[model samples]
Every structure is written in structure tokens, then in C-alpha cells.
Target chain A: MSAREEVLARLRAARDVGGSTVPDVPRDYHRTGVHAPGSAAAVERLTETLTDYRATVHRVGDLDGVPAAIAAVLAGSSSVVAPPGLPGEWLGEVTATVRRDDPPLSVADLDRLDAVVTGAAVAIADTGTFVLDALAPDQGRRAISLVPDHHVCVIRAADVVSSVPEALARLAPDGPLTFVSGPSATSDIELDRVEGVHGPRRLDVVLIVPPRA
Target chain B: MTTDLGMPTVASDPHGHLRGTEPFPVAAHRALADTQLRQNLGHATRTIRAKRAAVVGEVDDWEELRRAGECVKADVMARLPELLEQLEASVTARGGVVHWARDAEEANRIVVGLVRETGSDEVVKVKSMATQETGLNEALGAAGIAALETDLAELIVQLSDDKPSHFLVPAIHRNRSEIRDIFLREMPDVDPDLTDEPRRLAMAARAHLRRKFLSARVGISGVNFAVADTGTISVVESEGNGRMCLTLPDTLITVMGVEKVVPTWSDLEVFLQLLPRSSTGERMNPYTSSWSGVTPGDGPQTFHLVLLDNGRSNVLASPDGRQALHCIRCSACLNVCPVYERTGGHAYGSIYPGPIGAVLSPQLTGIDGPDDVNASLPYASSLCGACFDACPVRIDIPHLLVQQRAAAVEAHGRPTAQDLAMRAAAAAMASPGRFSLTERVVKLGRLLSRSGRIRSVPGPGAAAWFGARDMPEPPAETFREWWGRRERS
Candidate 1:
């Protein structure tokens, strides 16, 4: 018999046997009863986790104040790359040269750009991870968020989840979800860490609080 | 490309050239003696282990996640053929092509053919064990295609022409100065005067690979997990090199082991949480890129998934041994293994070295081989259970190791002088009358010893143990002797 047939037969045989018990994967995350503790509480936990990884976290009270917040952080930068789907209202305060995430931008040009502000598809509260799908409107090409010196990912409280299982349920299988826990870092040397080896050097998470209903 | 016949075969005993009778002790002595390698391994592993612990601890459902990860893997293994067919259909529907390789030779041929068809003489590679096990780079090089390793540590090893020493951190054996020297010597157009500083070395590598990233027409990668439900493959890495390789090329060829398959996208949650923390000691990797087939004008225009089965099916056959297939290649078992800590990975003979290699290598290749290296792999471990405990999949490595040892002994035929001694021991153990007779004889010999311990004994049995360690003196009397004396009194 062919090796392929042998493997298929073995897989079938192993499956037929009831020797090993199946392990429990987390399908019922809600049964855990871990409440959100409110959006402010969730943001606080996120800030703590982000700071633990040494990333800078900032908060904006309202959407109108977002542009000013962005300007304050990127004050000296003349050019800012906005994700194609980025809300223009957030960039209203910035009077400097703004670069929209265009397809032609090379890795070198993206490196030269001042900053990028893109909305995340989901913010994992448990892991402090932000998922960016390429299809997401404001999040330009993945290279834009990855190559730039500074990345300001915008996360809304409602998108935040308490566990990885919860976050996985919200994501589409075919969609591209670039899970970013923190800025790029590596300890390839004699156990000495060097950040920004290939990705963003500075990660500035802009937590946009939902407006009071 | 035509050198398939020349590739080392199992019976040739390739790694035996580097091994000795004192395999573990010799390798461990050298590794432990190297203060630099020891310090580097210690610190690197501790940091990653700690990060994994912290991130893994954050979620109360982590145990559940681990269980889920195991179950999903088990499920896939059970329904592998059906799921693979489903996956093939899905991939084909999305304009992606699939190829099946029965073994390393077949896998290499398919990859070489694919790269040749792309008409590219060079291809960028993301770190993948499937490629390594097949010796794909060497095959590609022989085929006249330059396979460039994009992962930082892999790049260092590639530049130095060295084999990987660790699973996750391939260059764990090398220090910063070694890396700098390699960069200075091997990198084309690299500055002659480069410092051993981490930042400088990274920048130099970055500058070197940026060109490859932009110009390469074909990209080769290994997937951490393939979501059978969506026909999606996930590549997680700290460096954006993977992202570049996955996105920049027109044609992307992913070589994945059949074991990497998962039932659904939801299964990714269990592994995404398990892998990052376990391998890199991070809450999440810097980049977790998942692409399905080909994207229109965005990522690769053409995608090929090479489902590799070099020796995985053989491993999946044994009841106890099949659990070894569940390994995620996290290198957690290696880090915590006392044996691996001393010998490093090179001693294992196969591309996969360490505790996982001990059971895996022999099974992958049929056990009916004359190679001393394949025979020696099962004995490499101390059966301390440390590896099994450290394994993310919880493979009972010790159980498999013992089973492999039995298989090895059986393969070698009935009994050598050592086997006869063990058989004699079994006989003595089975009959109390013979056991007492042997005990009395041993006790009578103890009269000559000044101390309770015997410094040495004269026999073939003594040679194996006394070769490395001092033999302890025999006790003045056996527990049976004492019990007899008590009853008489």
C-alpha cells in the first residue's frame, strides 16, 4: 500500500479507538462568570498589562479630543500615516503633513513616516493583544502598523474581551487578524533584549472611551 | 537538485560520527563546561519560561485552554484523512493548490519543483521544522535555489553554516560575539568593523535581509497551525520577517507537517495562547499572521500548501509512541531536560534534537536499522519525567523511551552479555531460594570491605557504571539477613 493510504488508515484506526480521553477546550467562556468590571476597569487592566510590557498608554475622553491627543503625542512629526479606514475626526487637530496609508508606500517610506493610528478589530483584555485584520477599513496594510517607528492603535472598550477563547469567537476564520501584544522585541543576543528590530519601535495605545449613552 | 540519492539515509548513521559511547556525559560535560553556553541557555530559557508562566497564569481558563488544545489535536489526529480532504477541497476552492509528500524525499522534490516552476533561483524561508527535517535548504541549494532563512536566529545559523541547537531559539548555543563574528565574516557588504552590541548586529541583519524581502519572488514558510475549517495557515513570529515573507512574494509555498492541522478556527485560541507564552515567553507574539489562499493584489497571488508526512505517520502508529506526534516544537521539553541541558541538540542526530528527538527520530525512520545513532537515541534520556512534565502536550516521553529501549533491545536480538546479566537478575528475582543464595554470596564478599560501601567490583556489570562514577561499597548485610537475625533472636 502507498504511504498516504497507510497514514490515512492509521489516522482512522487511532480515531476508532477509545483509548485516550478528549480534552476540554473553552467553548463556554461565559460560564466562568468573569464580569467585564466596566469599560474603565477594563481599560485600567489593559493599561496595566501594556505598561508591564513597557508600552506607553494614553487615554482620550471623547472622539472630538482624539485629534488633539494624537497631536500632543506626535507634536514634532510633520507627516503622519493614517490607516485608510482611520476616522478623519481623530486627525482633525493635526495640522502637520499627513500621509494616508497608500499602497505604493515602501517599507523604507513607512519607516520614514511619523506615526500610524488604526482601529483594532478586537482588544484581548486577558492578553493585552490587539487584533488587526487587513480588511479593516482604517487599518491600512499590515506593513504600515508594523514598519512605522510609532504605532498608536485605537481600541474601544466594547471590543475588549476577558479571554482568548472569547476573542477567537469574534474573529472570522478567513480574515487576516494580526495579533499584536506589544511592540516588536527580541532577545537573540546574549539574552539581552533589543526592541524595534524589525517592527515598530514605539507602541502608543490610544484607548478611546465610549461616549456616555 | 539531483543529489537525492546522495542524501544521508538512516542506516548510514550520520550523527554517529559526532557521538561516543559516553554520549550524554560527554555532551553534557562539554556544554556545562562552556560557561557562556550555560549562562546563555539559563537566562534565555528562564526569561521565556517566566513570561509564559505569567501570561498563561493571567487567564483562569488556561488549564481549560491546554486541555482544549490537546483535545483539538487529538480530534484532528483521529479524523485526519477526512479533515485533510476537506482542507484540500477548501484550499482548491480558494485558488490555492495542495501537494502531498509521503516522506522527506517526496516533500523536497515537490518544493524544489514548485520553486523551479516559479522560475526563481532564490526563495525566502520562515523557520519551519518540516523544511529542516527534509533538508530542504540543502536540496534547494543543490537544485540551485538559494533558500534564505529570515528568522533572526535561523539567519545566524544559516550564515554560520551551523545546525540549530534549540527548537525555538535555534542559535541558543552562540553568544553575542559569535553572532557578530558570523555577521562580519558571512554577510556580503557587511562593515568589517562591527561591534558585538545587540542593536548593531540586528541593524546589520535588518539591512542585509531588507533587500531579500523586497526582491524575492517566492517565499517558503512553515505553519504553526492550519485551520482545516477555513483553509487558513498561521505563522507566528517575533520578527516581522515572517510577515514580510508571507506578504511580499508573488508565490508563497507553505510546508506544514500533517500534525499541525486543527479542526476549526476556534482551536487557534487554545494554541495562540499556549504557543506565544510557551515558546517566546510573551503574552502574544509581535506578529501572528494568518492568510487564506491568495489575496487579490494584497498578499501572495499564488499559494501552495505542501502537506508533509515524512515520518509522522510511522510515529502515529505506536499506541504509546503516537503521543510524541502531538509536540508543538515549543522546546519547552528541551529547556527543562537535564539531558538536553548538557548535550545540546546536535547529539540527537536528527534535525530534531533533545527529548523529543530521542523517541521521534527512531520512530520516524523504521526501527529496523543498523545505525548506532538511531539505536542510541532511546538511551539518551535519564527517564526523569522532567521532559514529559515540561511538554505542553503532556506526551508521556518516559513511557515511550522505555518502550523504545525495549524495541531497540529486541532489534539487536535476544541478549548480549549485559542482557544475560539482566535476565539472570530476573531469574534471581523470581525465585526467593536463588535470591537468598545470591544475597549470601554477596554478603560473604563484604567481609573484606573495611567500610560499608564497596569502592569497586570486578565484573562486566561494574564496567558500565564504574566507568564514569565511583562504585559504592556493598552493605555489611542485606535487609533479608537482618530480618533473619531478628527472627532467630
Candidate 2:
């Protein structure tokens, strides 16, 4: 028999011999947080967690405040690239030559740029994490967010959720997704956490709060 | 009703890392004798333990979450065959090919062939326990392809030609100074002025592997969780190397144990919370990358998923011992195990070294007899119940350990002297007359007691058993005798 057939047959036998007792997994664990998504408390928790993870956080009052926040985060970066679908107005104040991924940038193009700016699909306040879906035009492809040393991710105040399950519920498993909590870090050496290895060493999370939905 | 369910599925991959090299006692004795290793193990485990406690303590519903995680894995085991079928179809529907391997050799062959098809002479690797278990790098090396390990700890072990010593930190046996020496001697372009500082050492590694990650055509990795419902496979990692390999390579090959497949996408909710807090003592890992299959103008358009059995079927056959299959490779059990902390991971002699490895390795490759190296694993644990308590999935590791011990005794082929003694004791205890007579005869041992303790006894394993501890002297009078005297008074 082929490997697939043999393995399946063995699993079936074990099921038959062991008795069929499908377990009922309880979902009593907190699926949503006490603080509502995008609430003041939720935003406060997000800032605390992101700061603890060593990501620089800047909060702006509204859509108009996003340009200055993005500009300040990318101050050290000479060249910045934004997804084609990313609003042109978000980078209006960015002094760095803001390039658009119109034709879709290559690895070489992403390598030369100092930083990349994009919008997040959602952000979790409890874990200080954000999700980037390739299908989200604002999020662009996975590589664009990965290659550059500095990643300036713009999260709207309303996107923040309280817990992991709450954040996961808003996501679809249909395409490539990246869940980033902090800048690259490792605990390999003597089990001590040292940040800045491999991925973007400098992660500037810009939380835009105003223009309330 | 069933004629053939595949009886001898217990044999593991010949090239796999399941079997230990030597007996546990002997290897552990050698490891304990090394003071430097004991210090290394103590510091690393203790550091991780404290961090884990702090993170896990903060969660208000931690126990509830662990329970849900445990039950979810149990559900996956009950629905194993169906989940795997769904996963294969989903991955295929999304333009990814799937291959199945029964053992280690087959897995190695299939992966090598896939890499050869890509026609790349080299591949960059993310740190994966499955690859370590299958010894993939050696197979690739023999086939004239280089598989460079990108994780800092894995790279150190690779450069030194040493086996991994821990699940989370493979080079825990080496301090920063030793790491510096290894890098200076082995790495080709390392700076001469390198110090033992971890930040500097990590920067050095960054410079070394950057060219490889950017230029490599093939990337090899292991799956953390594969969502059968969506054909999505996720890799959770801390360092950016995982992202570099998963992102930069043109073709990607993922080797996943069949037990890793979960039925639905939502199942991730329980495990994601359970893993990081338990494994690395962090609220979240630095990055978690998941992709369904191929995407145009994106990372790794060509993808292949290899489903590995390698004696997992053998583990699944046992009624009670099968819970070993629920492990998520978090290594929390290892950090809390007293035996592991003292003897260090090297003593276990398997890629999986710790309380989990002790129960898991034996079940993966059935204990043939006393001489079967994996047989000693069932006895490696002190059965303090720490492992089960620390397990994120609540595997009941101590219960499983006893079950494996019973299985080992049954599979011994011939009874040992200890087995005969146990049977005799059981028989004596079953009958009232035999029990009374045995109790009466056992009190005669007071004649040999010096200070109400039996320092030595003569039997098959008595000397070894008495080496570490002394037996208390039997009471002079039986309980029934004392009861009769009291009644007469």
C-alpha cells in the first residue's frame, strides 16, 4: 500500500480499537477583553505592551496627525516605500523620498530602501501585536514589510483589540499573514533576550487615534 | 472486523533521531560528573523557569486556557485521519503539492529530491526539531547540498559539530565566551576583535548569514501548526532569520509530523496563547508567519508539504500512552524536571531531551527489550509529577510514564528477577494467610538490624537499590499480634 493509505489505515485502526470518544473542547477562556476594542483603556494597554516590547510608539489625534507621526518615525530613514494602495496623504510630510510600490518592488528595491510604511489589518492591545494580510492593499506583500531594516506600521486606534482570540477572529486564513509583536529579538544566548536580529531591528508603531469611527 | 491495521508500524526512521545512543543511567552519570555542564544547565533552566512563571501568572484565566488547549489536542487525535485528509485537499487546492513518508529515510529522500528539483546547491534553514529528528542536514550534505542553520544557537552547534543540548536553546551548554571561541575558529570572515558580549555576537551572526538568506533559492523549515480547514501552515519564531528564509527563498519545503494538523482555523486561539508563555516566557514571539500556499509575486511561490509518520502511529495505538502525541514541543517539561536540570540535556541522548523525550522516544520506537536503548527512557524520570504540571497541554506525563513502564515490563520477552519478585509480592498480598505469614517472616530481619535499619540485603538488584538508601527495620510485632494482646488485656 502507498504511504498515505498505510498511515491512514493505521490511524483508523487506532481509532477503532481505542474507542471513538471525540472530545468536546470547552471555549470558556476569555474570547474578548473587558475593555472594548479601540477604547481608551484598550489604547493605553496597547501603548504599554508595545513599549515594553521595545517598539517606538507615537500617537496622533486623527488622519491629519498620521503624516507627522509617519514623518517623525522615518526621520532617520532617507528612503521610504509605501504600498500602491496606501493613502498618498499619509506620507505627505515624510521628508524621505516616498516611493510607491506601483509596479511592485523587487527584493533589490526593498533592500536599498531604508524603511517601509504600511497600514495594519488589525492590532491586539493585550499582546502588543498587529496582523498584516497580503490581500489588504494597504498591507501589501509580506516581503515588503520584512526586508527593510526599519518598519513604520500605521495602526488606527479602532483596530486594536483586547486579547489574542479577539485579534485572531478578525483575520482570515485565506492568504499569507504575518503577526508581528515587536522588533526582531532573540533569547538564544544564555536565554537572555537581545533585540535586533534578522528582521526589522527598528519597529516604529504609529497609533493614529482621532477621526473617530 | 479488521483483518489488517498495519501491525508493525512501530519501527521509526532509521536515519531519525528517536533512539538514544546509550543507557540513561550511564550517560546521566557521566554528565553529572561534569561540573561545568551542571552549572550551565542549572543557570539556563532556572532563568527560563522564573520568566515563565511571571508571564503565566499574569493571565487571569491561565488554567482555563491550558484546559482548552489540552482538550483541543485530544479532539485532534480523535479526528486525526479526517483532519489530515482535509489538510491535503486544502493545500492541493491552493497549489501546493503534498507528500507522505512512513519513516525517517523516506522523509529524507523526498526532501532531497524536492531540493534537487529546485536545482539549488544550497538551502537556508529555520530552526526545526523535525529536521533535527530526521537528520536532514546530514542527508543533504551526503547529496552535495549545504543546509545552513540560521538560528544563533543552532548555528553554534552546527559549527562545533555537536548535537543539540536543549529544545529552545541548542547551545545552552556553552556560555558566551565559548560561543565566541567557536565563531572565531569556525566562521570564515569573523572579526578578530570579537568579544563574548551577546549583542555583539548576535550582530556577528547577522552579518554572516545575511548573504546566504538573500541569495538562497530553497528554504527548509518545520511547521508549528497546520490549519487543515484553510491549508495554512504557521511558523512561530523570535529571530528574523525565520522571516528571512520564509520570505527570501524562491522555493520552500516544509516537513511536518502528521500529528501537527488541527481541524479548524480557530483552534490556533488556544495554542498560540499557550505556547509562547510556556516556551519562552513571552506574551508573544517576535514574528509568526503563516501562508496558505502559493502566491504570485510573493515569497516562496513553489511550496511542498511533507507529512511524516515515523512511528507516530505506534504511539497512537496505545489506549492511554497516546497522550504523548499531544505535545507541542514547548520544552516547559524539561525546564521544570529535576533530573533534566541535574544531568543536562546531553544525557537523554535524543534530539528530544527531557521529561517529554523520556516518555515520547520510547513510544515512538517501541521498547524491544532491556537492550533496546529507548527502553531506558521510561525509567529516566523521577516521576515527581512536575512534567505533567508544567505541560501546556496537560498531558498527564507521570501517568503516561507509569503506563510505558508497564508496557516495557510486558514487552521484556522474559521476566527479570525484579519482575518475579513483584509478582510474588502481589500474590502474597492477595491472600490473607500468605500475607500474615509473610509479615511474620519479614520481622525476623530485626536480627540483622544494627540501629533499627537494614543497611544491606542480598538479592538480584538489592545492592544497587540499597546503594543510595537504607531500608527501615520491620516492626517486631505484626498489627494482628498487637490487636490480639490488646483484646486479651
Candidate 3:
């Protein structure tokens, strides 16, 4: 028998001899956030949690507020990488020269850029995590955000969910996804968390909230 | 009907020198004397423990989540063969190749062959315990490939020519100054004025690794969770080195134990919540990169998943002991273990250490008939029950430790003095007559008492027990005698 067959055989024999019992999974845990889905409380909790993780949170009233928030976050940058299909108005007020990644920028090209701005697929309020599916129009290939030094992710209030399960429900499982919680950080050195290691050192989350009635 | 694959399905002892030659006690004794190691472990474990407790306390359904996680793993184990077949088909359909290895040697050979085919003399690596378990780096080096460890802690361990002492922080044993010295002495282009500050140290490593990440052709990693339904594999990490290696390389090879698979993408919902809070005490790790087999013009276009069984089947064979496979490699058990906090990771000898390692290593090596060091691992713990409490999956590590101890004792052909004493005590307690006779004999031991305590005794094991504690003097009357007098009255 090949190694595969032998291994499988052994597993089968073990299962037969031991007769392992599978238990029913109790999933009584909170699958949804305690706060109502897409409620103001959820967005507020997300903002606070993201801030706690050291990601600068900028609460914008709407899409119109996004450009100014982007500009403020990228105030010192000379050049920025914007993914293809990103709303043109989002970068309208920024003085930094916008570099479109329609053809996709090289690693060196991205490394030299000062910042990256993209939209998120969905955001989890409880865990303060944001998912970036490469197939999404605003969230380009994984490299665009990874190679740059700073990232400014735009999260609409509607896209913010209460928990990880809610966030997973919104994502397409087949696409490559990166769930980012904070700026690249490491507790590897003496188990002391020192933010900014290999990925973007600075993360600015622009929360686009809808106008209240 | 039987066909030989020219490889031993049941390896006599494939771990070799990796399972350190000395038993745990001797090694732990040497480790105990290192006050520096003890202090480093104490400080790190305490800090992580506090953070984990705070975050875990915030989750109201933490227990429910743990139970669900355990069930998912148990289901996976019960139907492992079918699930693996499903995983193989899904991955193959999505442009990934799957290879199976029965033991460590075959796993190493398969990995080395893949690197040779890539024709890359050097490979960048994420911090992977699977690779460490297989000793893949040593195998790759022998085949003329330099496997550069890219994770910050792994880099420290690699550069200093030391083994990883902790799971999350491999260099947890090294202080800031020691890390600085290692970087300065080993890193080729390090700054001359590098201080011992952690931020400066991180910056120096980032600069050093950037060049390698940009140019690497092949990257190697371990799987945190493999989604059998979607053919996706996820790696949870803090630093961006994992992202760099997983994305920049043209070819990627991942070595995953069969136990790492979960049934569906939705199952990740439970683990994603459990792992981060349990391991690093983060709401979520800094980065969790998940990719299905291969994506065009994005992450590695060529992907290979190596399914490793190196004694996992043996572990699955026992009904009472098989829950050991439920571990998520969170190292929560290690952080809370009283023994591990004192002796550190080296004393366990395997790349795996602490409470989980004590039960895991011996079974993974098949301790049924051996008097080797692996058998000694079953006795490495104090059975304090901290590891089980801290385990996110609730593996019941102390129960497994006791079970493995019984198996080890049964395997020993000759009974030791302690075993003889235990047998005699069991026999004496079997009946009221025997018990009363033994109690009468025990009253004679009052003669050896000095000032109401017996500090020493003549038995081989009694000396060691008496060294730290004193035995109390026997009571004047047996409990049975008192019960009979009361009944008469």
C-alpha cells in the first residue's frame, strides 16, 4: 500500500477498534451581537474596539466625509495607492497623488507608496475585525494593502456586523480573504505587544455613518 | 492482499534525538537551576495569563463556544478519513496538489523534493510547529536549502541557534538584551548602535527580512485551520511576515497535521473567537490570511498541501486518550502549568512542551512498550488541572496524563518499589479484616515518631517524600473499631 492508503487504513482501523463517539455541539453562544444589527450602538462599539486595537477611527457622516477623512489620515503622504473601482470621490480632496492599481502595482511600487486606501467587505464589531475579499471591487488583490506602510480602510456603518458569525455570513467563502484586526503588531519580543512589524504600521479606519433622520 | 510501501507504517521511534535523550526529571532539574529562565517564564506567563483571562471573561458564551469547538474536533476525528478525502478533492479541484505522508521521514522527503523542484536554494518560512515537529529545516538544510524563519520570535530562535521554548513566543526565554546581541552578532547588515529596546529590535528585523521577502521564490508554512468545504487554509498570526511569505512567493508548500481540518467555513466562526482570546489575548490576531488553493496573479499561484500522519493515528486509536488530538496549539495550557512555568519548554524535550506536550509527546511516540524518555513525559506534570481549565478546547489534559501514566506502568514488566507499596496498600484495603490488621500494624509506626511527626523512613521512595514534608503520627484507634464501639452503645 502507498503511504496514503496505509495511513487511511490505520485511521479506519483505529476508528473501528476504538468506536469513537461524537457528541452533539451546543451552540448556545451569542451568534449575533448583543446590540441590534447595524444599530448605532453596534457602530459605536466597533469604533471603540477598533480604537482600542490602536487603529485610528474617524467617524464620517457619509461618503462625502470620506474624502476629507482620507486626506487627514494621509496628510503627510506624498503618494497613495487606491484600488481599482474605489469611489473616485473618496480620494477627491486628498492632495497626495493617487496611483491606481488597475494593472496592479509591483511590490517595489507598493513599497514606495506612502499609504493605501480601500473599502472593506464586512466588519465585526465585537472582535473589531475587518475582512478584505480580493474579488471585491474596492478591496484589490491582497498585496496592494500589505506592501504599503499605512492603510486607511473605509467601513460603511451598514457593513458593520455585531459578531464573527454575522461577518462570516456576509463573506464569500471561496475568495481569498484577509481579516485584519489591528496594525501589524507582535508580542513575540518578551510577549510585550509592539505595534508595527511587517505589514502597514499605521491603520486608520474611516467609519462612514449614514445621516440620522 | 497486503502490499508493502517500503516505509514503516508503525515507526519504532521516528523522533530519534528530537525526543531528548534525558528523562524529564533530570532535564527539569537542570532547567530549575536556571533562575534566569524561571524568571523569564514567570513574567511572560503571568502577563499573558492576565490578558487571556480579561478577554475570555468578556465573552459570556465562552463555555458554550469551547464545548462547540470540542464537538467540531471530535466530529472531525470520527470521520477523518472521509473528511480528508473531501479535502483532497476540493483542493485538487481548486488547482492545489495534495500529498500524504505516513511518518516524519516521508513528510520531510516530500517537502525537500518540492523545494528541489522549485530549484530554490533558499526558502522563507512562517513560524510553523508542524515543520518543527518534522524537523523539516534540518532535512532541507541537508538537501542544500536554507529555510529562513521569518516570524520575529522564530527568527530569534533561528539566529541564536536555539530551539523554540514557547509556542507563541519561541524566543520567550531571551531577554531584550540577549535578543539584541543575537541580532547584532548574527544579522548580516544590522545597525551597529542597535539598543535593547523592543521597538528598535523589531525595526531592525523588519529591515533585514524585507529583502528576503521581496525575492523569495518558495515559501513554507503551517496551517492553523484547513476548511475542508471550501478548500481554504487559514493562518492566524500577529506580524506581517506570514503575509509576506504567503503572498510574495511564487510557490507555497503547507504542511498540516490531519487534525487541523474543520468541516466548513462557518465552523471558523467558533475557532476565530476562541483562538485569539486564548492564545495572544487579542480580540483577533493582527492578521488572519485565508486563501483557497491558488489565485491567479495574487498570492502563490502554485500550492501544495502535505497531509501528515506521523503517529496521529496511534493517538486516535485509544478511546480514553484520543481527546489529546483536540488541542488547537494555543499554548494556554503551557502558560498556566505550574511545572512548565518553572522548568520552561526545553525540559519537555519535544518541540511541543508543557502540559499538552506531556500527554501528547508520549502518545505520538507510542509509549506502550518503551522505557525511553518519551515514556517519562507522562510523569512530567503535577496534575494541577490548570491546563484543562486554560485549554480553549477543554482537552481534559490532567485526565489524559493519568491515563497515560497507567498505560506506562502496565507496560513496565517489573514493578518498582513504589508500585509494590501501592499494590500492598490496595490489597490491604480490599477487606475489613485485612484493613483492620494493616491498621494495627500501622500503629507500630508511632514508635518512629519524634515530637508527633515522622520525618524520615527506610523505603527507597520514602526518603524523597520525607525530604520536603513530614508524615503525621498514626491515630490511637482505627475508624472501624470506633464504629463497632458506637454500634454497641
For residues B251-332, what per-residue lDDT tens digits would candidate 1 score against the true structure?
9999998888888887787788778776766677777899787766467888999987665655655666777778888887
- Poorest stretch of ten by lDDT in candidate 1 chain B: B5-14
In model 2 chain B, the worst 10-residue window by lDDT is B1-10
Candidate 2's TM-score: 0.96
**Which of the numbered candidates is closest to the native, going by highest DockQ?**
2
Candidate 3 TM-score to native: 0.96
TM-score of chain A of 2: 0.96
What tens digits encode model 1's per-residue C-alpha lDDT throughout A1-213?
444554455555544452344455545433222537236666677777777665787887767667787877787777778877788888888866788866557666776787888888887766678888888788766667766667888777777776667777778856566888777767666444577666676788887776567
Q: What are the candidates' individual DockQ scores?
A: 0.42, 0.71, 0.65
lDDT of 2 by residue, B211-243 (tens): 888788999999999999999999999998998
Worst 10 residues of 3 chain B by lDDT: B1-10
* Descending-DockQ candidate ranking: 2, 3, 1
TM-score of each: 0.91, 0.96, 0.96
Q: Which portions of model 3 miss their true places by more than 4 Å?
A: B1-18, B368-370, B450-452, B460-470, B476-489
Instruction: Indicate whether candidate 1 or candidate 3 has the larger DockQ.
Output: 3
What's the true lDDT of residue A175 in model 3?
71
Give the TM-score of chain B in candidate 3.
0.94
The 10 consecutive residues of candidate 1 chain A with the worst lDDT sum are A29-38
Better of 1 and 2 by TM-score: 2
